[model samples]
Target: MTQNIKKLGYFLLFTFVTLILYLTYLVMVQGEQLARHPQNQRIAAQEAGIIRGTIYDRTGTIIAETNWRGKQGERVYLKQDQLTPFSHITGYVSQRYGAFGLEASYSKELLGLTEADYLENLLDRILNRTPRGNDLVLTLDTVLQRTALNALGGRRGAVVAMNPKTGEILALASSPTFDANEIDRPEVWKQLNQDKLNAPLLNRATQGAYPPGSVMKIVTGAAILSQQILKPQDKIQCPGYTVIDGQRIKDNRSHNSVDFNKAIALSCNTYFALEGSKLSWDQFEDNFKKFGLSATPDIGVPVRSGTLAKGERRNLSQLAESSFGQGDTLISPLHMALACSAIANNGIIMKPYIVKEIRKPNGKPISVTEDSLWLTATDPEVAKQIAQGMVAAAKWGTATAASIKGLEVAGKTGTAETQGNSLPHAWFVGYAPAENPKIVVAVIVEKSGSGGIIAAPIAREIFSMALAR
Candidate 1:
């Protein structure tokens, strides 16, 4: 009986110790993910009565802050310039509506819940002190963001601009934006939630996915050059259209046999569709996967992954369609911008980041961001050839509207045709000063025919503004 008791005691002690260790592991490993999770209801309660941190633009413009003196969180959206343009960036936080965007991504940091600040606050708890949240200093440039939004002119699309070298997002503007101030009201919430046509609540910049159209030709071009399947100057004949997998693929215009540069510049669909057929499905998928079409990039807000297909077994016709950004292929504006930025930055895609710094409540710097490489999709030589083609497109081809006199911009235009009655979506992705690139911009105008006419001009204005800075 004593032996039985001793064995039971030993088992119970072992179980208790194992449970404690497991909990400690969870605290150390899963702690940040748990605290920042959108489903954590405790965040809403804490936000109701806590002094959350301020959010600022790169230029020190206060985008969001809470009034702490009265009732803990009189969450105030300051009437700053270009506030509406940044609505998706500073997403709404409410007890009723839940949370998303930066409000959710950095919730733990903003709530001062990270393990680094834990023990300091434990001492505060002993002294009965009210803890303050940490401030986020974002990388967004207000002037650039406003330029992008205004350039969109209330269209149903988005624009994402970034520093190609550093991956610092200069501007992220989604069209049909709503006033964040109206979020607390029931009527406004219901109206925004139910509106089907515009869907003003959708953050089109990072979350909305559309057929990439000719802009996807950039990826196709990368694959061709990287795999050594085609030379930069390889000649191909385009008699308006060509048969691919029994489907007659048509180009925008008839062009006699031309080299790779002219094909890319003119966005000859026949050339790309034919080139795409030469690649096996594995080669095709591998190229785009390297370019991040298969996954969501790590950005400050929520981003949906752009998809190439729904299944593993892809038909030849599907490959042709996917080659030109049609069929089942869809991509987010930010994703395309990053891809273009990769080309601009010598094939090294830097990881995109918005928040540049984190500061304590008293304005002392906690940490500063260090830019890192996200992917090396191709050789610099291959990327340079693609860049040259983009420059040709800007100078003498479909992207002439995007050309800025004396600035030497390199760009690509895309008009992705949609099904049924929906018109083609206009797309323009580019970088400035081909020799020494600075800002890379991606502009998409929904159901807008002709990327050169509508989207390129929009991008031109943004590039003009960014360069002026």
Candidate 2:
């Protein structure tokens, strides 16, 4: 009996010690996170009292700042002088909803809570000086962003422009945007939340997903060339439609037998369908993954992955539709832009970056982020061939809509058909100055009949403006 009592006593002692140690560790390790819990109003109140850092553009234009009004108890965030022009990039920060965008991504540095900032703060404390939040400079060009936005003129679509060599997003514009200033108004917020047509809140550039249409042919061209089974000069016959497994797939325009250049230039559906079937569905899927279609870009923005429907290629008709960028493939404008950048940068794709540097209040660079390659194409030669084909597209193909005098632009246009009474989605993805690309632009117009007519024109205007700049 005494032994059993002693054993029970020892077990109780061990349990007590374990509980104490666990409590101590929790207090030491996760105490900060616990203290900053959403339910803790005290922490939020304290944060609301701090003077947040400013966000600037590449040209040193203030995009966002926190101003403390003497009359008001809390600090107010003025985004671009309380305007909504760059609201999406310089997202709003409210005590009620925490933070977002540059504010949220660099919150640690903005709040002087990151390790480096903490160390600096400690040093400042030792010297009896106040530690201030750091500023973030972005690669976004405000002039380009505004130009792209104004070019849309209330149209429902998106425009994304990136530096092809560095993958720095110069401009990202989504039309039907709302002003961030109205977010604090309950009545305006309720109206915005209820209105579906004026999905003014939607960030169409990254979040909107649509069937890539023929713009996907860029990927197809790369895949076919990489396999070494097809040559750039390969010839195929197009009889308006191709039949496989009793299914009939028709091209947008009828054409007779043509070579590879003519097939791509004319955007002949029948020719590509035949070529796509020869590659098989598995091979097509693998190549799609290789083109970054299976995953989203790591640009710290919300992006939807381009999807490929799962199934065996039963026959030529299915292959033809998929080859011409139809069937179950869907993609976002941002993803397509990056894919084009891959070809423009000679098979090497650089990861897209928005924020360029973080600096202390005194303008001392705390940290600088450099561009890095994200993916390399299966074959450098194949990329060159595709780039040539895209150049031909802008020169004499369906993307003639994007043809600008005195500029060699390589591009592809896509018109993806969908079910229902809605028109097909129009797409254009391309890069400027064919041999050495400086800018890559991807434009998408929802429910537009033809990519060449709808999306290409927008891209042309953007390219012209970009070159002029």
Candidate 3:
């Protein structure tokens, strides 16, 4: 009996020791995973108790913030109640849905829990107090945003303006916008939820993808320039249409013969079709990808990854259609702005950035964001040639509608045809001060025909406002 008792005691001790070791391993190795588990409502509730930091524009304008209230003997930090019209940028913290936009993207830093935040917290603890959370300063300009909105005039479209040198998004405006104030309200939510034609919640500037139309000629020009398949002086004959594999491709413009520059300036489909056919599908796909046509901009916004279609050589007709911004080619306005950034920055494309800096509540600088290169167009000479073509387009080509009176504007216009009875989408992408650019703008008008008439003028107005500012 004494031996059995001693054996039982030893077994209990060993089991207890093993359990403790397993628990310690779980805490050390899988703590973060457990905290992020959906069942951990307590951790989420604690996060909700703390006041999230504010988001400001470059001019110190409060784009998004939380307002604390001591109402009915209860302390509440209301997010949607304080920030309206800017919800798309700030996003909302909902009880039902997880955080989004800047809120979700920068949660660690905003909540004072990042590595930098940990150091600051430790320092503050040693000093016998808590450090404040950091604030995000954006590169947006309120004036430009307002002007862009006004220019849209309730049209179904989007406008994106950025500093070419810095890749700082100055203004982003999407029409048919919603009021963030009504997000938590049942009635307003019902209305917004039901509406189909006017998707007030969609961020068209980054998420909306459309056929690029003739504006795609810019990429074709780049491909031709890079492959050395053709020279700027090389001419192609056009009878308003070209046939490849018994398929007819039409040019909107009726130019008999056009050189590379003239073809781009007039947006001649035949010229690009012939040049695009000379290169293999892989070559075409590679060049398009280089221009960001087949990629997504890492701007923290929900961006669509535009696609370039692939198929057999007999699909050359389909590929030719894509050369002029038709068929299976699609792109977002934000990506188009980046493309223009490449041209404006002399073939060096900078990554698009929104946040400029972060700071503590006491006004101490905590973090600052610097400009970074995203991609370089294959050849600088090609970008230069494209810039010259864009200059001519603004001066005497289809993009003349975008010409600013005093500022040297270089631009390209695109009118993409869609299936069924829908009107074509209008597109305009450009950079200003032709020789030395300061800003790049991309505008898209859904179901609005004639890029020269609709999209170009709006881009010109935005450019003019930016210059004046």
Candidate 4:
């Protein structure tokens, strides 16, 4: 009995020591995360008591700021309707609802909690002066964001545009957007959340995952080149229909005998189905990973990752379907745009970032977002070949609707089938001035008919406006 009692005592001692060590580690290593967590109301409440810093666009236009005149320390959005294009991103700063979006993402800096501001913050508090937070300069251009929003008017979809070389997001617009001010009204917030049909509060560009459809042929084409099974000039025969494992698959129309370039431009379902057969599903998956499709993108905010079918390809039928972006392959519009951006950027995918810099109220810089390479999508030569294929697509194929005068564009389109009797999702991804690419845009309209018809025109208008500037 004494021995057993001693053993119990030793176990208790061991557990107690482990608990102390864990608490110490958490306090030292994970302190910042805990302090800034959205659910941690203490720090958030304290920040609410203070005057939060202003937020601006890259051009120094005020986007968000706090009003001190109100007794309740009301956080006010400037030019409310004019800035609703930024609604989902600025989020609301309410004592009742706390902070969100960039407000939540940069909470610590907004609260003047950085090491550089520690002494100054302490001094300001001691003096009983207003504790001001740091300001944020974002990469979004109000003009571009407004253009994108205007282009998507009345459509239930999203648009994402970024610089290919720098990964600086220029515009991210989601239709059915709710004004941040709406959150101040509990009844309004409740209605927006409960409206399942429109989902005004949802940030569709980063969070909504959908079938990629034939726009995924760009990846399929890359997989073929990666395996060295097909050259740019190699011939592929498409008879409009092909049999894969006794399951008959059909294309939009017969593309006949065409080379690699024609297959991509025509989006030949049969050709990719055959090309996809050359690779095991593992090889196909490997190529998708090369384009960063299998990874969750670190685009300075929370985002949903693309998904393949739950399991490995069980049969050639599934593999062939996936090649044409059928079956269970799903991707966010941002993911598709970034992948296409890789082709525009000579095979290198730059890490996407929005918050360009955080600055002190005195105009001193606190932090600047750095540009870095995220992935190497393919060999330079292979990427160039695929880029040319996209050009052909814009010139003579389905994506002709996206071609802009006086500027060469490389593009691909997709019309993904979905459940119910509704129309398919329309998608378009492209980059312009092919020689010296400036902007890459991805667009999707849920339950819209054809990507070339519905989505491409919106992309065309954006390109015209962007290049004109």
- Cα TM-score per model: 0.91, 0.87, 0.86, 0.94
For model 1, residues 205-297, the per-residue Cα lDDT tens digits are 999989999999989988988887888778988899888768887788888897778987999888888888788888998998888777777
RMSD of 2: 3.8
Among residues 3 or more apart in sequence or in different chains, the pairs in candidate 1 whose N, CA or C atoms overlap within 3 Å are: none
Model 2 C-alpha lDDT per residue in residues 209-280, reported as the tens digit of each score: 778888888888777777765788877777788786687887876778666667666777777777777887
Model 3 TM-score relative to the real fold: 0.86
Top model number, lDDT: 1
Error of 4 at 245 (Å): 1.2
Regions more than 4 Å wrong, model 4: 1-22, 70-72, 78-83
What's the TM for model 1?
A: 0.91
Estimate candidate 3's RMSD in Å: 5.2
* Tens digit of per-residue lDDT, candidate 3, span 2-80: 9999999999999999999999988998876565443456545655544557778889987766564431111122233
Q: What clash pairs does model 2 have?
A: 273-320
Ranked candidates (lDDT, high to low): 1, 4, 3, 2
Say which prediction, candidate 2 or candidate 3, comes out ahead on TM-score. Answer: 2
Report clash pairs, candidate 4.
none
lDDT of each: 0.86, 0.77, 0.79, 0.85
Top candidate by TM-score? 4
N/CA/C clash count, model 4: 0
